[model samples]
Target: MYRINPPGVYAHESAMTEPRLRARVERVAAALAPPRVPVVFTDEQLPELIWEGRWTEGLKPMGTLPEVRDPVLVFSTFRFDGKEAERGAWFDQLGTGIGGHLRNALVGGGAFHWFPAGLKEDPYRKEKVCRACWRLHFQVGCLHRCAYCGYGGVLVTMVNVEEYIEHLDRLIERHPWQLTYLLEDDADVLCLEPELGCLGPIIEYFGTLKDRYLIIHTKSANVEWMLPLKHNGNTILVWSLSGPEQSRTLEPKTGTLEERVEAARLCQEAGYTVRYKFKPILPITGWREDGARAVATALTRTRPDVISLCTFMWMECAEMVRRVGRDRFDPHFLAAAEAAADTIGGLRTAPFPEDARAEMYEHYLTEIRRWNETVPVSLSTESPSMWRRFEDRLGMNAANYVCGCGPQSTPWLRQLPCSAWQGVERNDQGLRGTW
Candidate 1:
């Protein structure tokens, strides 16, 4: 029987939480590690999304303009008309069948991942974060658009934040185990927070559950307001940082590296666990030396609990990739990154240059160790080759970290991660993530 929530209220597929069944599904998901960094969906699907107003509506200005703001980010609210209808319908479609049950149990609130289990469990995994984290989002797109960027400029808000909490409560009720929730996957949770006004209510809700937490990753410095909220040491505050050059060229509207670092410090001082993600490391001129200095500054200044490094993979955002001219990229490294391309997980991605990335990873890792040897150092393992190389270099896959929630699942259109992959067989066996 299908249980429906009230109008404008999103529903969970299974009313009764099946821990055993969820465990079965999650075990398979955790065991099957992917070969590349994959999102819940591919950039190829962006066309259909944009046309429906589910993604972007050009770089035009909209919403209540921030009186004290830059002219570039003209728009205040996301042009996500019909998004509620689309997501509501998607939830309805997944409301039936075992597939929906599996999705509900899976990390993405319905998106299935092949390998849910990452590195072996360690007691001191992230210092402050749970090793296993469930990814949740209240919005899509972002307000930050840098030079070598793709999804940052887009900001698609997901209404029904309260309704989603109701569904999440059922997820927790089903399995009342200690777990962490990662917020702001599609957009920075704290960037437009003042307008949305969701942090307090969401934090209060999480506090009710036994051992529940919220992890937010952002580059924006608008975190001062959240410092005073009672988090119970549950929220893991993260900043996606870069050196001065990359920050200036790539991240335009976002604040300076120093500003973001200062925000991390404020959070740290306010009694919150802080972390850093030196991702999509643009290996440009003097990148190694400069990057090392930046890493040194972050480690020495903020002393975050963890530092995860990664290189760029903009293949999914073809439009953005086209917008960024070839001159902006390291041509020599680009060739190598392109050569390492392979179908890892469900998406088709060519990861960052492995050799060049290995060098950059070593530099950041070395610098991080200099100031804070206790802080865990990590490398992004979105690709199989990248994961293998990092594991080989570090002598082990960095245990304490978070991975993508897998390819985007369009439940309204195609609930499966890849509708095309369903017809095919892997190793001549049954389909993966199939009911």
Candidate 2:
């Protein structure tokens, strides 16, 4: 009964012979425990990183995954997986950990610690750096078919979970400053969590860290497995939110708008500090009202510790749309995105148009902030010009909670700041208020 979706409820009829089902459930639950470590990754054990979509048309089906691990078997029983919403900031953040430096190193980036294998100067040896927020991910790539997502089809699985755990533990033991870590990016951790069989163990592992935050972001409502675990309030479950319309239509394969909110509520009820990411805000026709309603719904559903907001910054996501268009995604939106696409920060994106972006940001921000006045509402700033434009205007802090473009970030050093709003200054309201 501890599980929201109780164990054995979804079991096949053949296994419903009470004792057999119970035994099966017990076995599955037992597997969630952390494996005895010293995870040895031999020369043949290096993880595979494929840069392609898992599915041809929409999101890759869970069936497409090659592995038949026990966790994957547990995952197969679930519909979709954990949290909700959308974010393009991660596209930039993850790109850095994969090869690029983080905000501590790249100003505009966050303090991210990447997998040593990818970041090392030599294969076995590690690169030297001052400090990072540790972009630690046991998983990458997602199966959700959200239109705004860039990391589709190309599913990546991190096979070396025990090894990653070892590396992170060693890093934490050695470097006290590496307190924060982003647990996901390549994929929604919870989406494939059951199959991965790492979520419970990972949360328990991180719980041992004092004053540390392990942020898990997702657009799935597959949280049935999490309720039974003892989190110790160290894990922050974040949903990548979108306008309700966008959530339903654009990101259809992901959980429905309400389902995500409910999932967050479930996590909050279970003692996890839940957060929402209102990023890649698409202010299309009825976006204002839809966005407002969605924000209100989120505030009402979950006790959000913080609400991070960011408008759509296309990056390479638009090209993804061109390559593999979904039914709900509009051609006009893509056309507008293509037309609006340009270099922002170091990344090319379809930034909110100078005229419209300002008003849209002001309108939704004013509305979003109005809902939860006490919770620190953070906004995503991809570039310096972006930083300057949105900076201090909303009264929210620069965010390292997720995007790592907080007050400490300095990506501006390498990339020329965008000057779209050159003459504009934040009025008393922090917005020009002139559309």
Candidate 3:
């Protein structure tokens, strides 16, 4: 294992021969080979300029645009069947709304390369092979009517509990020793857990697996049902958080920040490890101070075991833009995302300039690091270089690798050097062990 120093930098000692690296690379290459999907869509198939009645007319720019150029129209696509009643409503609304813009931006500028028909082929599916630390949404639709949330009634949920559990069982069988599993398709696992009666069983099942870890994250404060469960080290509860301004404006349906923090405290007090995800970090005028204070308050209240930080990401989807609207959208947030994207070699070859994004990232990083120390920090859906810079600033290396196993492994591995191989000894005051 590698040893990670303060500020998060990684240094590896064991050198794999070219042949070994080549073989490992080959295996990953084979695993990443795109699977055949029944349905696929590209940007060219969608329309742009929704209700084209002068998009820029009378629209005052909210904030100063970062030095980065605006995004170029790239190809984008949305594929979902409207056959089932529940799913049909979701697809129709999404298609006519945010999905339209996403498709236009992606395909128009040739940004994202592929679009799958359903969530399964979306690559970020919750199964072990495809899932990332970012926690894939499980419920097809969201019930909460948060004004700022892009997903409201846009997705569907699986009504068949046993069948869904069986599907997860199959996934587990394929990767039995998997370290972590994150339920991401929806905001609150308990929101649907009460209806399906699956939370207890899922927790029990994961408990049976000695090495694996499970995390149930939510924005809901309806956690009375979770208070009674027998706690274990492998099971962690995470809560998504926003500042007071955001909670009042964008997330009126979700619990207030105080309530969420109280819930987190309750879980922690119950001996359940908890994680805090401060995502889509909004850029309201006083966001810097408000965001930091919110985080500090949460830390004092919950004393969480881990924390992850992320900014908003803009997809080429039209429905996404329409739902959020340019008015509420902060140019700084977009510029920060663009900067992160640029550092990673521009996921989309669009007009968003990389230099501007880099500056924005620097500003964001400097501001957020001021809140606290000791808690591990990471970005959601960020590029490698962005993370590299973060790690470098934190005096840490990429010792922690995220994916399906990231939630579990990151917390443990982040304690060591990023470059150290498993079983390696470090000179950090006799702290030596496999993380």
TM-score of each: 0.61, 0.60, 0.58
Which regions of candidate 2 deviate over 4 angstroms?
A: 1-132, 316-349, 396-435
The local distance difference test score of model 2 is 0.48
- By TM-score: ranked, best first: 1, 2, 3
Tens-place lDDT digits, model 2, residues 217-236: 78889998887787787777
All predictions: root-mean-square deviation over Cα? 14.8, 14.2, 17.6
Put down candidate 1 lDDT per residue, 49-164, tens digits, no spaces.
33443222233222211211211111111112324334334644543321222212221232211223233443332221123333565554455655553343243333334555
Candidate 1 to native Cα RMSD, angstroms: 14.8
Instruction: Give the winner by TM-score: 1 or 2.
Output: 1
Worst lDDT 10-window in candidate 2: 76-85
lDDT of each: 0.48, 0.48, 0.44
Off by over 4 Å in 3: 1-138, 193-195, 316-322, 325-371, 398-435
